[model samples]
Target: MSKRIAGPEIERLIQLLAKVPGLGPRSARRAALQLIKKKEQLLSPLAAAMAEAVDAVRICSNCGNVDTCDPCTVCTDPRRDGATIIVVEDVADLWALERAGAMNARYHVLGGTLSPLDGIGPDELNIKALIDRVAGGGVSELILAVNATVEGQTTAHYITDQLSGLEVRVTRLAHGVPVGGELDYLDEGTLSAALKSRTAF
Candidate 1:
């Protein structure tokens, strides 16, 4: 067994930081040290910000986006194309799509994909809300921007099946080689998708 290195407060900070994604115990210790070193400049402000977020942040009732309001900024924005809704597996995916600045459209976060092995199903996701939104009319298209995993595809297909009789046109993101990726570096499936989805140069 290792000896205790820090006080309870510092040890707790490191423990909580370690719970965050991509941050291990060693990195958390370094982070805790940095925060201690910059207490007034970083630690105090971060604490205050977290406190504020604790009271202010909420899940959007309409689309599952996390924000300070019930409907979120994306759901309330009049400038976005409400006729098209891009469905994503998580808020992180929604943020990634927004960072790309490619589509000025609304979004629906499904919370997660269908994974029976993990006991995650359509009812566990925000799939019912999505169906309600589509059935309410005005939505003309649904762009499935989910991951390429089996669970993601299964979830997408389930959603499509649910909206079978709806007038909305359901589509999916194209699979192919990335913009700067080399052909030799890509796998057979990616190469085949690129060939099948070839566009005019």
Candidate 2:
């Protein structure tokens, strides 16, 4: 067997890093070594940033978006359109939408989708908070930007049913083939959605 090379502290760091989403033990070890090699430039700054995030990270009470502030920058930003809100499945999705810069609307992070098998329900998500926000009025459109997965669609349907009595118009993010995607490579769902949502040139 290959003998353990790292000290206890370094080994611990690798183990912790391996637990990160896309990192594995080998990658973590490489990362740890790199961090140690560039301690002053990378390690110190990363550590400080992590510490600051740990101390300040919070969920926005109004929209469930994660940020350092209670209301979050998106919720409080005057530039965003208060009349339009995009409902997303996760904070990551919210960030993705923001990076796209397609619209200047606010967002509501659902936290997660409804999954009975996984013991996740409407109560577990930020659905109630979203309903309350919509109930407050002035929202002209509620865009459901959840994923096209089974759980995501189920959650979308449930939310649509819930808002049946509300006067606001609910919309969904259009799912179709990628800009340069070939029809042969697309799934049945994608093909169906693309055909249904086809627009005139």
Candidate 3:
């Protein structure tokens, strides 16, 4: 067993911090030390913020987005175009797209993609809700902004099949070389897609 270098409380803090994404045991130890050092400033505020979040955070009933409200701000926003919906794999993708502000449109979160190997299927995700929304009308276009993974593509295909008879136009994100990316570092698939999807320059 490893030697006890700190008190049980501090060790427990490091253990819990390690469970967070991108944080390893060593990183969590460093973070715990920093938090303890700035107990009055950073730690106190962070603790309060976390407590508030636990009380206020809610899962939106409409689009599956997490907010402090039921329908979420996006769903109730009259300024956004309800006719255009960007379907993403998760809330993270939704937030990323919102940050980009690519279009003044609405969004739908699938919760997760189809991963049969991982035992996640159609019913596991929020797909039925999406279909219901489309069937309810007013939605004209559906942009599948899912990742370029096999599971993501499978989920997109499944969603498309479900909406086959619907009136909505389904589109996928264009795969290509990123802005400022050199062609030498790009893979064959990206190069091919970029060439095929070449637009007016």
Best by TM-score: 1
Better of 1 and 2 by lDDT: 1
Every model's TM-score: 0.96, 0.96, 0.95
Best by lDDT: 1
Model 3 Cα displacement at 113 (Å)? 0.9
Give one digit per residue, the lDDT tens place, for model 3 in 123-164.
999999999999999999999999999889999999999999
Residues 144-166 of candidate 1: C-alpha lDDT, one tens digit per residue: 99999899999999999999999
lDDT of 2 at 24: 90
Can you give the lDDT of residue 108 in candidate 1?
97
RMSD of each: 1.1, 1.2, 1.3
RMSD of 1: 1.1
Clashes of each: 0, 0, 0
Model 3 segments more than 4 A misplaced: none
What is the lDDT, from 0 to 100, of the residue 136 in candidate 2? 92
Which pairs clash in model 3?
A: none
